[model samples]
Target: MAELHEQLQQLWSTANKSFRNVAAYGKRNGVKLSPSTVKGWLGGVVPDSTTALTALVEYLETAAERESGWQRLPGGEWAALYRAAHEAKVKARQKTSAPATTPQRASSAPTLQNSTSPAQPGDIEKARRILKAFPLDASWFTSFEHQASFHRIHDSVQDPLYDGQNVLARNYKVRFLDPDLQRQSEKFHDTVNAFLHSLDHMDADGKSGYSQIPTEWRRSFRDQYESLLRKLSGQRDELMTEYGALINLFNERGIPLLPNGS
Candidate 1:
């Protein structure tokens, strides 16, 4: 059995729950995690599988709610936290099981591979692209509009794309079971999600803030919008480059998935 990850241990500690408590919950669900599994998690071993993660998170959340007057974590937040932690675990496994394939960068580099390299760094790109055969024009859904209609592109365009980003990220993580590309998909998903969330707080017509603004605030709004737009474009382009590279790899291997990514 592996040690419990330190953060997992701390979360459990803060909940005042015992390791035995988690095992009990798993036992009820017929999963039956052991005492050493808790140790393993603390000792930096990730959960054996999603099943174990779900069980641990369930126990943690249940205990946390009970300790905090029984207020359950919001379902969405709960899932997000679990997913983020699970991904971190996936990242850790990738590190130990493999090796650093690219020179580590300063603040902004990928935890796995650098995205901005003129070419994909290593064999990971080959594996990353093989999971999906992108449609030539299929990126329409993922593409950001340079010229904004601004009426409700937030609703019609950005939001849907944000949702799609999440779906694609999950498919990479769970379906293809590729953590590296899963991280890239997650980067795109998070940037889109952040952009979407920002839309709710803005005083303008849409995300671009150019809809019908007062002249005084219009300059600042436009500045903010441009900044946001540049990021959106960059993130979108990176993913597209990846998709294009993936397609190239597929062609090289003579095992192209259908253009529709089927």
Candidate 2:
């Protein structure tokens, strides 16, 4: 275990990054742990992935290997350990952060089983958190592990029909929430589009153009990216189950299908 900490320090030195960078890397990869966690990990403290999902644990493990030249240590061996240790914590966090799931709460938030009520503020907040699971950042695509972690989120911010099954705005669409969420949804979609555009433009203009555009884009939107994504994806995925049940209704109706409008 002492050797593990030493190796971690070596990786930090080799990468020329501070402990803060290490912590940020873990959080960005979906673990929600900090530098302190990374420091503890070095001492065999075994950081929690904060959920039962194996992907988050895999991400942090992969990130550790990539950033530091560690040849897979005990941390990689602890998916079960981390999951067991953190499952309670995950439930605890959800219990505290999430809104009540009572009959009235479910109705207010729109449970397809019973209600299609207008989404409340709590629903919005929950969806935003879920959407962060698969953010549109280019940095997210560096590895299959990273990419897989991304797809885990059912996001429809880009095209309501992009995945049809996972749109944040469409999922939370209510008489009261729909208009505002749709508008906010556009911002999320636009950011993703801008990223794709930046990639297209990256080769032609250089990374400089990509960086400049987001500064301008980020300024246009007032909300944080993480928050918005969670709000949208959570409610969206919750609704998709209900939406799928009415495929007959969709096919019965003549939804326009046009390509460039002949």
Candidate 3:
């Protein structure tokens, strides 16, 4: 575990200082992470939630791949080392997070009888009433709106490609080349897929279609989608906000935003 921690720390260190800024960006999204927090995690102070770990991993991966051209390092050594270290860290964290077990069961316990009893008239009537009240139409409409909203955002983001003429062709070309924009495009794709899947099972009962879902199901989905939308909005804003900061850094070192080879 300690060796894994060391490897993770080294991996984090290899990326440029932009990593710190990215960490700060993640913190703004409610991650509460600093570069030091990443250091601590790599040193075996596991993050309390998988969400934190996931955010850290995603930021690091994106930063590293951005810096390293998305190519595997020579001999695939860096990726191999990172994978092993990450697996170990995950296992250790899971062990730490699992609930403690009790040594013994309580003495007083009820036994079940095998005899089957038919449903009472009142119970059958209650179930029928409940099923009659299930919100299938509402679920279907909400799902449709969710899918449509995602598609609209997807199409709007691709508007840059049209450049006033060949919109579809231009958008495709730009997305193929622009990593930042591509990530947003992929996220929109995934959200749309998830929304579709949710709709398929939305009204299912006991894992079947038409089952009553928890009251919070739609609310939770809405919350998570909203959070992701906000993050995407932030990332887009940062392209502008950090442009000056990045330009200044490059200018101080006599480097142009576009290198000579490109």
Top lDDT: which candidate number? 1
Q: How accurate is candidate 1 locally (lDDT)?
A: 0.48
Q: Write the per-residue lDDT of candidate 2 for residues 67-102, one digit (tens) a residue.
A: 765465454544544554445445543543344343
Instruction: List, in order, the clash count of every candidate structure.
Output: 13, 11, 10
Error of 1 at 77 (Å): 12
lDDT of 3 at 139: 34
User: Worst lDDT window (10 residues) for model 2?
Assistant: 200-209
RMSD in Å for model 3: 25.7
1 or 2, greater by lDDT: 1
Candidate 3 worst ten-residue window by lDDT: 161-170
TM-score of 2: 0.21
Off by over 4 Å in 1: 1-97, 100-134, 139-164, 171-217
* RMSD, every candidate, angstroms: 15.2, 17.4, 25.7
Better of 1 and 3 by TM-score: 1
Candidate 1 weakest lDDT stretch, 10 residues? 205-214
